[model samples]
Target: MNKATYQQQFTTEDSPGWLAIDDQLDQIYGDTEPRHYPPLCGLHYAAGGSDPIDGASIYDSNHQEFHRHIVSYGLSELYYDEEKAGGEFSKWGFELTFRLLPFQDDQHDPIWAIQIMNNLARYVFTSGKWFEENHFVPANGPIRLDTETEITGFVFALDPELGKIQTPHGEVSFLQMVGITNTEVEKLKQNPTTDAVKELIDHLKKDNPLLITDLNRK
Candidate 1:
């Protein structure tokens, strides 16, 4: 479809890209809708108003361990013809996803992951740096503030299940966040190669395919 046609035929049901993302989540959760969160104060670029993208959180128990999966909208071409829609990579080419292990009795969804997503978005907008598979970045401290957890950095990887989808805009990949400790980050820096990061992730996935960030790992 051309840009004008795409713009005219863009309802949520008719939205190929956006609906595909929702459908992927639906297949996994089966009739369960995620708890969607919109930012309280708008992101810096939105002129202190409403947020451009919405965050969705879903609790998954089927995996060997239970964790909350948070997904971000708006990183890519969520709406039809919002921008040119033909390229190998979608608008930003990827959406940010985070999987966090939850406390057994915890009832409320953790909002920290949403904050991290927004911060990453801000960095992209300001710095023009895009994160891709096998890229590692330092969190500078515990991923969770004021906590003593050893996880101090994050590595990106294609989500095992929600790998990639062809959208009206192009191709979008779901880049998941896997936390690592200072020691692991240093080891990765010494090598500075994609294989080095992949090896570390491969080791982590052996125990947990979802690659849940283990704050207690030594």
Candidate 2:
């Protein structure tokens, strides 16, 4: 939608951006109530009591085999503010997403995904740095601390299913975080270019089209 149109339409809505995001998800998820996880604590180093990422919603995936899809809130301007209306890009122009196979026992909730997103948001809120398409991050250790897993890092890609959407606040891309092995991290570091990341993602898509992060994949 055009800036003028969005501005006019969202003027009276309390949280137009938030609603827009929910509406987009509804298209994919229908009426399924996702497992939502709010910020664990009120205090954060950058935003203090207000976290940069307000919450995370995890949905049972339809496009992948027994995987969960996680989406974030607050990476963008989720609430309406007259000053931010119809901007070129929403706060950061994107929210983080992750698709993962069951990381633990089947009954175990995916709260870890929420924690990871908050940590990533904390990095951005504190460092003034932001991630973009094809960026990669090495997790120093297992992506899950104290876990015996080969998945030691991540690579960002536009979510295959959610892709991107235009909101009253601006454009928001669902940037997906895909787990990678330490070996893959080393390969990405060898070139450390968007192309390298893209190539790796492309190769991954051949078998895993949805790019679901499997902690068991070596």
Candidate 3:
């Protein structure tokens, strides 16, 4: 099981902010590869070691793929907000990176990448039901990525042989015993009522009206 690495770069177009970034869709550089560029490029990641996604096209449109990056919505701190630069400026927000480890069939995406994308989904679903089964609920309580500038720009390298990931900055030991899977979620399901599971479900179901609308299921 391999994990994918993603990097987010937040910028503010005013005062020459993000002078080093662009809004292109085909240019980026980091220790690894991003499956696609920004603006809801048809796919995104999610919590747990799940599969890559075909992002809904209602809200974001991969408008500026270059300036778009990854981050944990639950952890993202920055967001764009300005009146003069129109609504497309990349200012007033911090960049984020998500690392979805690589696997045999699917590619890697950054962690928290799903959360960020889901927020986008909420805005898209505002007008109607999603997939005809799940209704849209505006995303809220999302994590911000602004305060993590110091560590958000760093990278982690994989050491398959040593069963760990090493970076010029630091390292994380990969426990081969579990073999990398989303079992964490499955395990959580066993107890149907744990606080941790409820929190996780709440976060995952933020945009899912079908889940939240129910008062008995939870």
Q: By TM-score, who's the top model here?
A: 2
What shift in Å separates residue 48 of candidate 1 from its native position after superposition? Answer: 3.8
Global lDDT for candidate 3? 0.26
TM-score of each: 0.87, 0.91, 0.24
How well is each residue in 3-73 modelled by candidate 1, as lDDT tens digits? 66666767545656667688777777888767877664745234554444555555564576767788887
Ranking by lDDT: 2, 1, 3
What order do candidates take by TM-score, descending?
Answer: 2, 1, 3
**Model 2, residue pairs in steric clash:** none
- Quantify how close model 3 is to the true structure by its C-alpha RMSD in Å: 18.1
Clash number for each model: 0, 0, 33
lDDT score at residue 186, model 3, on the 0-100 scale: 43
Better of 2 and 3 by lDDT: 2
Error of 1 at 131 (Å): 0.7
All predictions: root-mean-square deviation over Cα?
2.8, 2.3, 18.1
Instruction: Output the TM-score of candidate 3.
Output: 0.24
Model 2 agreement with the true structure over 1-218: per-residue lDDT tens digits: 55576567766557877887899899898999998877767653346665668888899886858789999988988876767776788888989999999876446777777788888998997898899989999888888777788999999999998888888778999999999999999888888999999999999999999999998898
